[model samples]
Target: MIQRKIPSAEEAEKLKALGLAVINKEAEAVAALAGRINGNFAQACCHMLACEGRIVVTGMGKSGHIGGKIAATLASTGSPAFFVHPGEANHGDLGMITGKDVVLAMSNSGETAELLTILPIIKRLGVPLIALTGNPASNLAREADVHIDISVAHEACPLNLAPTSSTTATLAMGDALAVALLEARGFTELDFARSHPGGSLGRRLLLHISDIMHTGSEVPVVREQAQLRDALIEMTNKGLGMTAVVDARGRLTGIYTDGDLRRTLDREIDIHGCRVRDVMHTGCKTATPDMLAAQALQIMQENKINALLIVDRQQRLTGAINMHDLLRAGVV
Candidate 1:
C-alpha cells in the first residue's frame, strides 16, 4: 500500500494562513458592496420592479452557478425570477423571455460567445438587459440597459487565475440586487413564505387559525352556568384538555382548562356545585380566524397557556385550538 505523507507543522501553518488570506480577500470584496449601491443598482431594481414579467438570469460557467443562486433568492423573496443557460438560448429556450421580462446577464469578462450571440435577439424582443461583469468596458456591459460592475482587485488564488474573489463578489452583488428589489416592492415575510410553501417558513406563514382549528361538534364548549362536572365532560369528549365557557346567549365568557381543574381541586370546590363561570378563567386570550397559526403560537407561548379559543367580532365562540393542534400542523 502507498503511504500518505503527513504535512509538517510549517507547511500546515502556511496552508492555514493561505486559507485565512483567501477569506480576507473575499471579505474585502463584499465590503466594497456599499460603494456599488449607486445609481446603476437603483436603476436595476427599478427595471425589475416595473417589469410585468419574470427576471430571466443568464450566465456561463462559474458565473452561471452564481446566477442560479441569485435567481433563487429573487424568486423566493417575492420577485418572479428564473435562470436560463446562455448556451441554450439559441436552442429554442429564448422563447422563455419576452418583451415584458427583464434579462440579467452575468459574465466576468463579458465576452462569452454564447451570451453575445443572444444579445441581438434580446434587443429585438425589447427585453431590458442588466449585465453583471468584471469588465465594465466589455461588449455585454455596453449593450445592456444597466450594468452592475462586480470587478475585484485580485482573485483569492495566489496566481490570480482561479475565480475565487471574483465569484464571491459576483454572488454578493446578486444578493444585493435581490435585497434591493425585495425592499423596493415592499415584499413581506408572508410573501416569501407563500413562495416557499414546502419549507417551514411556508407552514408558519400560510397556516391560519381557521385551517387547523376544531369547530362545530369538535369544539369543547359549555354554557357559563354549566357545572364544573359538565365542562370537564365536554373537555374529555373533545380531547382538547380544555373547554370554552359561553353565556346562555352563546357568547364566550371564559375558559376552563386542566390547570383550572387542578386549582379548583386545591380549593376543595365541589365539581357538581361549582358553575363553570365561577371556576373558569376569564379574559382568556382569543384569536381571530384570519390570524396566522404562528401568531397564535406566539400568543400561547407569551401567555404560558396550552389552548386558545377563537371568537368572532361579536364574541361568539366559533372554534378552539390548542398546543397539540399547532404541533400537529407544524405551526409551533
Candidate 2:
C-alpha cells in the first residue's frame, strides 16, 4: 500500500462547498415537494387511513435505513407500519405482505434491482403500491398506484454518487406523511400516551392524585378539640409530617405540622392540654382527589408546603398528598 498526499486549503474549501451544496439541493427538493402537496397527497393519506392492515415499508441501501425510520415513526404516531428489506423479501420475507397491507417502496432511481425483483410479486398479491422515486416514468413509479415524486435536480455530493440530498428529501416526505395521517385520524395525546406508556409523557398523562395519595386510616387526622400531643402522635404515626384538624362532622377545620409545633414550642405552649385548634394553622392549603399529580406539585411549590389534605367540596377529609408522593409519580 502507498500513502496519499493531503489536499491543500483550497481543496478542503472545495470539499466543504460540496457539503453545503448537498444541503442546499436537498432543502430545495423539500420545498418543492411541500409545494406539490395537492390532491395526490390527500389521496395517499386517505388510502392509508382506510387501510385495515399495517403499512409495509421496503427499500434498499440508504433508502432502507430511511424506510426503517419512517416505519417506526408511523407505528408510534397511530399508524400501524413496519419495514421489510427488499433483499429479504426475495428470500421468503414476501410472506409478510398481505393483500390488505399497503406497500411504501422507496428508490431514488426507481430501479433498484432487488426492490424491482419483488415488485411483480407485490402486485400479484394485490397490495396497493405507493412509490417515492426521482423519476415518475421509472418502472417503480409507473407501476405504483400512487406516485409521490421526490425528484431532485442533483445530489449535494461533489462526486454526485453518495445518497445525500435524495435521502434527506425522502426522510422529510416520510415525516409529512406520518403527521398528515396523525391529524386525519384525530390521534389525541392520551392515545399517544397509551402507545408510549413507558415514557414520561405517559406517566404525566395517565397518573392521577388518587392513584398515589395516602387514603383511609393512613391519613393523619384529629378532631379540633384533640390535644396538641394527640395531633403530634397522629403526625408521627402517619409519617406525613402533617395532621388534619377536623370538626365533629369530619370537615377540615385547620392543619398542624412539625413546623407549627416548633413555633408553638418556642412560645412555651402547653402541648399536653392545649387544644389542636389553638395551635394549628387555619385555612390550610388543600387538594382534591381528582386533581392531577402535576398540578398538586405546582400547588406545593407555590405555597412552600410539604403536604396537603385531600378534601371534597364539603371540606371533608378524603385523602392526603405529600411532596414525596409527587416526586415518586414524576410530577416534579
Candidate 3:
C-alpha cells in the first residue's frame, strides 16, 4: 500500500477556495440560463399550463434525485407533477405517462443511457418533452421539443468530473420552472397550503376557530348575576381557566377568569355573595368561529389574553377558544 499524505491547513483552505469557485462558476451558469428564459421558457410554461394531464419528471442517478425534488416543488406550487425513475419507466412505470402529459428529463451529459432508453417511448406516447442538459447537441436535447441549456464552465470538483455544479444548475433551473409556473397560474399561498396540508403553512391557512374552539354546551358560561362561587364551578368544570358572564338573554355581559379571581381575592372581595358582574372584566377581546386560528393567536397575543369568547353578530356566545386550542391545532 502507498503512504498517503494528510492535507495541511493551507491545503484545506485551498480546497475551500476551489469549492467556492465552483459554486460561483455554477451560479454564473444559472444566471446565463436565466437570461435565456424568454419565448422558449414562456412556451414551456404555456405547454405545462395547458396540459390536461400531469407533468412527468424523469432522470437517472443524481439527476433522478434532482428530478424528484423538482416534481415535489412543482406539485406544491400549483403544477401537478411527479417523478418517474427512468430505470423503472421501462419496467412498468411508463403506464403513468399519457398523451396529455409532458416529460421533463434531466441529464448533465445529455446521454444518460437509462433516460435515452425512455425518450422514444415518451415520444411514441406523443408526450411533449422538455430536456435540461449541459450539452445542447446531445441526443436528449435533439429529440426534445424544448431544450433548456444548463451548460456550466467547469465542475466544482478538483478532478472536474463530479456532478456538483451540474446538479446545482439543474436544481436552479427546476426552481425557475416551478416559480414561473406558480406565477403564471396565479397560485396563492392558500392554494400552496392545500397541497401541503400536513405542514405548518397548512395549519395556519386551513385551520379555522370553529374547527378547534370549544363549542356547544362545552363553553364555560354563567349569568352575570350568578355568584362568584358558581362562576368558579363553571370554570372548573370547563377547565378553560375562564368563563363567559352573559345577561339573562344569553348575550355577552363580561368575562370572569382565574386572573379576575386572583385580583378579587387580593382586594378581599367575598366570593360567596359577590355577583360575577361585580368582578368580571368588561369589553374582553372576542373572536368569531370562522376566524383563522392564526388570527386568533394574533388576537390573543395582542390583548395578552389566553382565552377568547367566540360570539355571533348579536353578541350571543357561540363558542370559546383558548391558547390550548391554538396549541393543539399547531397554530402556536
Candidate 4:
C-alpha cells in the first residue's frame, strides 16, 4: 500500500488561509459589480434583446472559457446565443457573425490580438458590439457600441498576474446579463425545462405518469370478486408488488398488495375461499394519467404506499405505477 504524506499543522493552516483569502477577494469583486449595473449594462441588454439573430460571444484564453458558459446560460434562458472563439474567428470563423446578430466580446486587457484583428469586420457588419473588459480605456472598449466594465481591484493570485478575481467578476456579470434578459423575455421555468429535456429538472417537470406507467395489459389488476389467490397470481405476474382491484364496470374499488397478502397469511385466512375485496384496502390514493411523475412520487411518499393506480374522471383503471418504476424513470 502506498502511504500519503500529510501536511504539518502549520502548512495546513496556511493553505486554508490562502484559500479563504482567494474566496474573499473573488466575493468582493462580484459584490462590486452590483454597483456597475448602470446605464451601460442596460444599453448592452437592450442591444441583445433587440437582436434578430443569435448573441455571438467571443473571447480568448480564460475569457473564452467564461464566454462559452455565458453563451450557454443565455441560450438555455431563452436568448439564442453561442460562443465563437476569437482565434478561430480570425482563421475563417468570422463568417459566423451576421448583421442581425449581437456581438459580446470579452478580454481582461481589452487588447487580445486575435480579437482585435476581427474588430473591423464586426464593425462593417453593422451589428451592435458589446464589450466586457477590465480596461475601460482600451481600444476594444472605446470602439464598442456599449461597454460594461468588469474590472477588479485586485487579483487573488499572489503575483497579481493570473486571471482570478477578474474571471469571477466577468462570470458574475455574464450571469446578471443572462438573468436580466431572461426576466425581460418573460422566460419561465417551463421554458428552461423545454431546453433541458434530458436533465433532472426536465424529468421532474415534463414527465407525466402516462409516460412511465404500465398501461393496458401491463397493469396488474384483479376484479373485486376475484379470489385472493387470483389477486396474488396477478401481482406475481405483473411484478409491481400489488394489484388494483376493480368492480364489474372496470372502475377501481381498491388495491390488494403483497402487504395485504402477508396480513391475510398472519390472520390464517383462506386465500382460496376469501374474495380479494374482503382483504383489499379502499380509499386508496390515485393519480391521473396527466399528473407529473414527480407529483406521483410525492403522493406515494405522503401516503406511505409503494404503488399507485392511475384513473380517469370515470375512475376506470387505466395504468399502474410503483416506487421501483419511479426509480427506473429517474423520478425518484
lDDT of each: 0.92, 0.90, 0.91, 0.95
RMSD of 3: 3.6
Task: After the best TM-score superposition of candidate 4, give how far the Cα of residue 120 lies from its true spot, in angstroms.
Answer: 1.7
Error of 3 at 46 (Å): 1.2
Q: What is the lDDT of residue 316 in candidate 3?
A: 98
| Candidates sorted by TM-score, best first | 4, 1, 3, 2
TM-score of each: 0.89, 0.82, 0.88, 0.92
- Please tell me which predicted candidate would have the highest lDDT against the true structure: 4
lDDT of 4: 0.95
Task: Please report how far candidate 4 places residue 63 from its true position, in Å.
Answer: 0.9
Candidate 3 per-residue lDDT over residues 33-92, each given as its tens digit = 766687777878888999999999999998999999999999989899999999998899
Error of 3 at 224 (Å): 1.4
Q: What tens digits encode model 1's per-residue C-alpha lDDT throughout 120-148?
A: 99999998899999999999999999998
Question: Best candidate, TM-score-wise?
Answer: 4
Clash counts for the predictions, in order: 0, 1, 0, 0
Ranking by lDDT: 4, 1, 3, 2
Model 1 — TM-score against the truth?
0.89
lDDT value, candidate 2, whole model: 0.90
Candidate 1: what lDDT? 0.92
Cα RMSD, each candidate: 2.8, 4.5, 3.6, 2.0
| Candidate 4 residue-wise lDDT, 1-332, digit = tens | 99998999999999999999999999999999988999999999999999999999999999999999999999999999999999889889999998899999999999999989999999999999999999999999999999999999999998999999999999999999999999999999889989999998898889999999999899999888889889899999989999999999999999988898889899999989999999998999999999999999999999899999999999999999999999998887
